[model samples]
Target: QGTRELVGKVAEALASLPPVTVYEPEYVPKPPVVDTSEPLDIQRLDDGHTWLIQGPWLQRLMANVNFDDYESRMWFDKTLRESGLYQQLEERGIEDGDTVSLDGYEFEYQY
Candidate 1:
């Protein structure tokens, strides 16, 4: 019953409205622009951490880290420890128990 009343009200409202004329401009195809910019590079942000450039690999790894879950965080840490970047950070003088940050998430480094 309410739906019928709503439909009737909508029809009445539409009937009372003035007509609108839509003007669509001519569609012109734009020339495709070639990419000539340099690719993004990774950088060391601190003694214990480096800034990860946005890429498919980084996105896939970060997608698994859930800050609210302990197990997920542990998995992320283990993954980081197993990766070549861990050795790079160590060579960069990252000490045990030092806080390491990656993509804004911070955690303690352990051997």
Candidate 2:
């Protein structure tokens, strides 16, 4: 025998749904981007934006695990430059989302 279901009686018919249903998007709007140069190390990201980023202690624990470098050093360097170390003091600390401003200069970075 075939797998088709037997038809129900007219009394068993289902009710129709409402033609319109209200919907609200769950998305929260993101802040607009104001461009600044910055560096992002998970360490630094953890430092400045603790709420927005992860903790360094956890990152340090994870860093011990080594991975193969399939990428060139230049790639890493480019990322570092964007981190905004150029504006930071030699002794200053930086976090991934932290913006640094120095004498007439500014940049951003992650520790």
lDDT of each: 0.59, 0.37
- Residue 35 displacement (Å), model 2: 2.8
Report the CA-based lDDT of candidate 1 relative to the real structure. Answer: 0.59
Question: lDDT tens digits, residues 1-111, model 1?
Answer: 599999999999999999989999976443222221333234555543533444444456776667797766666666655555677666767667766555566666677
What is the per-residue lDDT of model 2 for residues 27-101, given as tens digits with 9 covering 90 to 100? Answer: 744322323333323223334532222333323322332234323323333433454433442344444665543
Best by TM-score: 1
TM-scores for all candidates: the values are 0.45, 0.20
Candidate 2: what lDDT?
0.37
Q: Candidate 1 — worst ten consecutive residues by lDDT sum? A: 31-40
Q: What is the lDDT of residue 93 in candidate 1?
A: 72
